[model samples]
Target: MPDIVNHTFENMSTAQPHYDVIIAGAGPVGLFLACELALERCAVLVLEQAADPDSPLKRMPFGLRGLSAPSIGALHRRGLLDALDLHQRMKNPFVGPSSPGAKRPAGHFAGLVFHHEDIDMSQWPDQPDGLPASLLSEMAELETVLARRACELGVTIRRGAAIAGFDQEPDRVTVHAGDETFVGGWLVGCDGARSIVRKAGGFDFAGTEPEFTGYTFSAELSGAAALKPGRNVTARGMYLQSQPGFIVLQAFDGGAFHDAGLPVTREHLQDVLRRISGSDVTIETLHLATTWTDRARQATAYRNGRVLLAGDAAHIHSPLGGQGLNLGLGDALNLGWKLAATVQGRASEGLLDTYQAERHPLGARVLDWSRAQVALMRPDPGARALRAIVGDLMATRDGATYVAGRVWGLGTAAVRIA
Candidate 1:
């Protein structure tokens, strides 16, 4: 990338460094965007709310993330693909049911598996051998690697601070975070679902209501033997024990529990688990746990004057099929170059507008994908029948190929340059 540019924030009042771009959130998306802008010699500053980037939730089973075709291609093109070693070591979690000798399936949709033999690789002949259609990664690993790259390219990351508020001028944007103030030519928000920038920037988020509250965690279970292995579709809900203590529960509660923002205690977890699993399973020790709903929403516009939105700040959906992380990464990749060009005075008249025009449709499609899964996962007779039909179709070559293509983001066109 570009040479390191010296930036100091020792005393905000003494010397406040100016930047071409100021990004909110130090997650993978924000960090990746920083690296992209710095690659073109644009001074960048990243403001993160958390004091420490390290978290247990960002590692292992809890933080497991999937890299789609576009994400892999983007990293490879930037010469950062070799820096990732986790995918080579970690096993693919998308692989379906196993037998004594069965060809491991490539992926799934709503627990319906699709085999490798069924997918027609000829359909995606444009895929190069060097870049796989999809790979496995961890959130912690991705953020660490991307952060390292961003720092190398002269991006300043300010942790323990966030975009509390900002003012947009005709020439630049002035951001206020805690007691510090920073100035930048343009501001991009990559902060998560409840983005302060998106809210303060007056972006309208529109989407559908959730059908269920999903839980993911690792806990000690007293009646572990009662719970069946693999994904079990019960009349109450769906439960999956991917590993010994790692469990995934989908309770059809109309997303009430998750929306209430109640604490995820062991007693509540056991109650939900018992109800969903139809087993008398009790969580002995709640190690790690988090709750999410299939609530899907997208911002009406990605950019507002000098302020922009990317990653989860732009859109959000259920973590089903692991589309959330990939979608955010795709957003950062799509916006970084265009925003840099605009800042550098090399962009065309409508270059920045294309960011939303092209990406919005894709984001909507992903939201619909999550909604469809929620439909199939419903604990109703109609949904059960539909799930059966869908499962049967997924076993077919054509069906498997189509679903796999979408899941892995195959056949996605490259960004057009002005």
Candidate 2:
């Protein structure tokens, strides 16, 4: 079990609630936002549904998440960059043959690799110094680091307390979790995709339907040795074995199996793998499994009166290019200081509103980015030809640099849309 520390309010006996801000999730986004608020002396209370922070899915290769340039810069600015130790240890999958003058690959888009030699960093004249274009991070370690910082800065996190419902008034929001009621001057829902706060708050979630059902799992396989390594986008579907026994499968089921809400079983895994890989792979034992789809959706607005939304609560997309976490972290980063200034009465007339204005467009772009990947991932001759063309372009200097700039979330000046 993961170590869970819960803080109890000493004034529980009193009628008035003590917190200035109430957060509805203890995930990285919420925790980081709490750290930001606490840094400026705002009392924050984070309510989480999970009793423990540790999980098998958050460990090792399974939990591997790539940190983009912006994310690394945010961590460095907060003085927590040195706390990350995994990037130095994990083998860089993109590091090509170490022959003389070999170009290490930076990242990929829809499995099309981009090399560092092609990316012209000089294009980014305003780029900050001493920051890698990208880094690898584990989800569990990220949460642990952010959580520790939040606690140190006096943010109270209450585990096993899911926000059941909330009532927002003119000046404050009343949050109901378990049998207790906590009040805060403002509420931000950093809860995930199926956010209860979003549902209860009546936010409009708009997006495109899913094209396929995606699976990520670990299992014991008898004929796994027959399968090749790395990502393979087959006509039937896509399959990637980042490591032995750990696999990811994308089956074009029109998101049926995922929306069916059926539990993942060994039989299902075997069938999917065999069909996708065209190999008689037998699953001897199923260690872990989960299903998702490309059902991209985003809240029309991030704020609803005094109750606001962030992270997956505000937007959700396919985990293509590992952009889900990065996008959420960006939301927290963009909103933290703005919302903090608003809460502290230091914000200008429309500073608080800029959070939604700036972030909503970015969220839309990410959704489109995911959708574009899905379009190319289709098992058709046209998609295959397009993928090949994209691969060719990615090998070019200008193409790789452009994609790298977008992937690392760089080379954008704030533009006003009148």
Q: Please, what is the TM-score per model?
A: 0.95, 0.94
Per-residue CA lDDT of candidate 1, range 1-418, in tens?
A: 2122323344335468888999999999999889988887899999888877888877756577878888888888887888887557434553424776787767778877787878988898888786778888878878888888888888888877867899999999999988788999999999999999999999999998888888888888888988876677789998888777888889999999999999999999899889888889888999888999888999999999999998889999988788888888888878888998999999999999999998899999999998998889889999999999999998888999999899999856675322
Top of the candidates by TM-score: 1
Tell me the lDDT of candidate 1: 0.84
| Model 1 weakest 10-residue run by lDDT | 1-10
Q: Give the TM-score of candidate 2.
A: 0.94
Question: Which predicted model would earn the best lDDT?
Answer: 1
Per-residue lDDT of 1-418 in model 2, one digit per residue for the tens? Answer: 2354556433234464568899999998899889888877889999888877788998857588888777788888889989887558434452223457777767778877787889899998766787886788888988998988898888888887877899888988999887889999999999999999999999999998888999999988898887877778899988888888989899998999999999999998899999999999899999999999999999999998888899999999888888778788888878777778888899899998988988898889989988888888889999999999998998999999999988888854422111
Runs off by more than 4 Å, candidate 2 = 1-4, 8-16, 89-102, 412-418
**Candidate 1 wrongly placed segments (more than 4 Å):** 1-14, 94-97, 416-418
